[model samples]
Target: MVSISRRTFVTATVAALAAPARGARAQEGSPRAGGRLSFVIQPEPTTLVCFNTTEGPAIQASTKVVEGLLTYDFELNPKPQLATAWSVSEDGLQYRFELRRNVKWHDGQPFRAADVVYSIGLLKSAHPRGRTTFANLLEAGAVDEHTVVLKLSKPAPYLLYALAAGESPIVPRHIYDGKGDPLQNPNNRAPIGTGPFVFKEWVLGNYVGYVRNPNYWDSPKPYLDALLVRVIPDGAARAVAFETGELDLGGSTPVSPLDLERFRSLPHLGQETRGYEYSPTLYGLEFNLDHPILKSPQVRKAIAHAVDPAVVLNVAWYGLGERTVSIVSPTLKRFYNAKVPTYSYDPKAAAKLLDEAGFPLRGRWRFALTHDFQPFGENFKRSGEALKSALAAVGIDVTVRGQDFPSYLKRVYTDRDYDFTFHPFTNMFDPTVGLQRFFTSDNYRKGVAFTNASHYSNPEVDQLFAQIAVESDATRRRALIDRFQEVVADELPVLPLMLSKPVTVYNRRVVGHTIDSAGVQGNFAEVWLRG
Candidate 1:
């Protein structure tokens, strides 16, 4: 195993800090303080609350209204947001944070350390990504009005990164504490947060609006008086809105590949492939091990061999994606494992494997299974159809079910009702942030949302994740993560198809639209429109 020296890690961190800063553009003159910015959001979230759902739309919408203890810069480096500064124990078991004083929630309630404690507790229990990311958090308590401390059972080196990823948005204890099942709280429709924007209104399937937070911690920020997020589901319509100056910004993947070149020719438009820096997402087909046919590793391997990711990239993604075998994307410099087992496009091999696994096509099709296409983007349906057609050639019949964001989450994450699903597993900043939960057996709760949907449990893989979590040494941690990927590749729990690049389009009149590596979830506090 190759060791990642401390120097290398420091260099990476330094390099990240050295990246281009995000804020008002220098050429755009002084930062003006007032204008409404209209933008396009493709997926219409079921709820305005981000913590209740893992839908990308919900999270992106909530980002403007809610603020976390920390957030990432353009280069994916952790920086202060709600919390001004922080310190960690030498052993990495305890964390101390200094909360920003004089901050008030959108409802005028003073922000306090108790809110931090309550928010952390809520994340540990209710939030999907937070459940695994903050699993080691033994206790979190407020030391004083402006101070909070977190006690972990074991070392969690990536905890800060997880907190900064926008998954665990801090909510007010007064509003959410006594609410029956915080997930179902009505306040989710109109959240009260301490961020730069105040939730003004939400019209389902139409639009969600936000006005400037007058009492925001940072004065004179959120230059725009209001932000109007239009739900334009059709890619062409969104592109047209952007082109016609009807929308100041087009949210992630708002402009389809077919329309990208045309938009590039327009001088008033700007394109970005940044903002997904922290989340190196892997798009793939996740198998449900609970199913009898899919329980066989050979069948899973055959399915992997049947589908050609290159073809999917061309037809569905328009060659905008990179083929991947490992669950982690190659962009994650430190933890990516390039040597994992890869499956080539070979239908003959897939058929032979199916025959050996007892599902031989003597006269009729070997078996039929249902697949759910996760509503990540419009192209998911095309990708699902491609996979279904590919598997048909191997005598495996598949029925593809396309669902909206809410229904898809309910069926796959809550009900666990399907045999296979096409979706992207994201937030892969570190092994602990995104990848660990999928492999750990303990995370496979029956009705829990965004746990182990695949129901895959390997003792060795679980042990490796546990070891990787507490291992403080950078070198040893990378080694353990490499081993974990090898186990995942061997088991074929999730056949990784491609790594997706999130695209964001905007009108050049909108200045200070900082495109961070965090992708579409970029901060809009400083964005101002030019007349």
Candidate 2:
């Protein structure tokens, strides 16, 4: 945790890893069967309210219990889901969606536009987080019982992609109508979903399991009779659990060098141990422009200029990450702006900016950082120390304030207490939604569209962001994006750092499992056991 939030950062930065060499030999896909998938499910997010508040793995585990309106494929395209098809108006203001008929909630209630309306309403009215994630979509009014029509104040090109994310999961209002609190009730412990699996039971902090939904809408999904999720926190312990037959998978477990070596030393090389990016996650110094000292464009630029991301990639991560400049991963080439300047080892230049900004002495200000048990905590600490010394030489003071995740989230977003937070943004297929959400003034102190934590904004940047959201043309949209980033770079609302890599570990028995870039989507539907 950093000075920004005290409860939870609400977003996870664990995603991406250095991809295999371009010409690396290809391996065939493997699918395993049965033999329950056991791994860590953070006890922190057991209740619906807690998970909804922080939006962490606890609710992620619930993805098995609820289904989104749409799903995104590896390419970030909208895949089929509760909705069969959708349409956008020529003026870029109105959108209409055709619902997939004959779907049912876990309680066997028919799902219609009313359920969609109710879920969105609940998230905005009560859910502590993600209210902004659905901001644009909420602008619409349902056209009929089965059709939802959205009329945006402005054009938004990525609305479809945004709806595909789990943050926008649809809940059945019928079941939650009078169930007391939507969170913390017995219902969460025994939830229901239209997805492949339905909640069966939770053994407190030990495990929360699921069984295949016999009446599931998706064909050939949830391949197993039961999915067993066990809570194992220690990274090494999870890996060891897999090696010794105590676990079937490694959820949220870092595949460290020791684990990799252990897997390599085992009987199977390609078969037993698997490594890849499970999701698209990004980790960087989420700066607060709201703080006066950091508000200086020169100061923010200097920090970005001084940051040595490659060092984090090569040393802190044992060469597991990519030293990337674009916030959108290379996998998202369409949105990735290659022209963005890359941060190098430039402590001198960083100092120059501070001096040029009239802080001529050196190190003008200091900030605090709180600590979370992310794999990069040590890395950020080392980098922060070096930055402190570097900025001090040039008349700046950087104080590192470290806090835990829970505390960090509450303070930063809820209380607006952070000066700078080292955190990651969760990945969604649509970069526009992610970018616009964080930059907008309305989203500040709340949702994706909220004002910057740095409390910074510009009319021009705002205009460009709105334009890009509705500009469906690829070339034009990208051009608008570049302009937006240029303004951001000039203002230093956010200091863009490195693209992240999700370093994941799994057992040999787990097959057909490819972690998406966000590391969201356990995708248990396609996962099976082998041998």
Candidate 3:
């Protein structure tokens, strides 16, 4: 019984059979190299700074040591890394690129075009979804030392899907120029990348090594000579270190749906839930609208009709997931909005919207609230104790808490402190890269690590996310992203639960690992080691 098969990222003929039309991975024999792979990364990346954190384990531990001027090619399209080519203009407001010659930067310097115009002006002035993913940059220099250009103020057809998103990595303008606060750069914990592994050591909470760059600009591809990673924040100690072979990879959610049927009866295990089919990602419960009882939209629609997303997808994702009431993930079929408003599983219509939002029920608790829990899986502490037993069967008490992963990104993005949080919002492939900066009020700034952690302002969701970011008429940007998901599903700020898929397991003597859908930027440069 070894079938497995569940990889999806549909269309483009199933992402050209999901990997291998240009990021090579056909594999059968020949292509031997040295070995040392390892891999685990579960909650232990406070900084190995992949452009100062949106933390998917610090951008999957800096996508094999950073380098991006276009990457995604498991049919999330746009390829050329470190810009081997690019072009745009016809009023898409200019672009250019063409860099990659003699590349270097794993401290061997070189890699210019002024380091891709200083990594797009440090991802549009310090990244946290970098000012809405470089919001129509008006300038970006160096059209020489191997070319680069930019100049946009308007038309940004998803800007090369946000520069093939591993969130624009190309750093090193002489180690972040006089680095005072390139997010407190000490080369963001020893990073100097051109990618194919080089930043060699990160012991905080145990392992994070890397080695083989041997001048890695695709020369003899990264056939692994070292890469440890291993942070294993207990999901049954990362499935007993991937069933005792001591892990040769686990990356995404690392087995914990009751240890995935005992690692599918491990015969030297190797399971994969297809490289995130272009990152759908939703999983839910956000709230924190400066929490004085989650600032009433009738108490966040009475906690989205008091939690049930099919019992949070069959008791915290054992039924593995899909419910989703719009944070846009119907496998992103062109801006998914499949008729928004569905908070159905009425706990007496959530006790009549918390007794018409004035919240009655005095002693039996009308509100307690706390939540937190996102230490990246144990299904976010069993969906925060199944959303505190479905908001304590509608009288609401909660209190959950958990933390770790830099104190849950410092209490939901630098101290907005939370009153509710379960996490997972990932790069939803568009609606201006994941639901318009979580409902922009200029992405709610307090210490800005932005994703608008529900400070959720709404002058009509900030004027329909500024006309869904320059709406280039794809039927009026799908009617302004279906009217910004019908005004954030009628203002529940954030609740649209379940829609995950992320799983990755590996260890059949590992070879060519390429799981796209960009969860942790999976492309270990043609992963190797099969002997």
CA lDDT, every model vs. true structure: 0.80, 0.59, 0.75
Among residues 3 or more apart in sequence or in different chains, the pairs in candidate 3 whose N, CA or C atoms overlap within 3 Å are 9-277, 278-517
Q: Report the number of clashing residue pairs per model.
A: 9, 75, 2
lDDT of 3 by residue, 133-190 (tens): 6778889989689888888889766766777536777778888787677888787888
Q: What is the C-alpha local distance difference test score of candidate 2?
A: 0.59
Which residue runs of candidate 1 sit more than 4 Å off their true CA positions? Answer: 1-24, 27-29, 107-109, 174-187, 203-205, 233-236, 290-294, 347-371, 375-378, 392-419, 447-449
Best by TM-score: 1
lDDT of each residue in 315-344, candidate 2, tens digit only: 555454566565555556566666765556
Better of 2 and 3 by lDDT: 3
Q: For model 3, where is the 10-residue window of minimal lDDT?
A: 1-10
- Where is model 2 poorest over a 10-residue stretch in terms of lDDT? 9-18
Q: Which one is best on lDDT? A: 1
Q: Cα lDDT of model 1 overall? A: 0.80
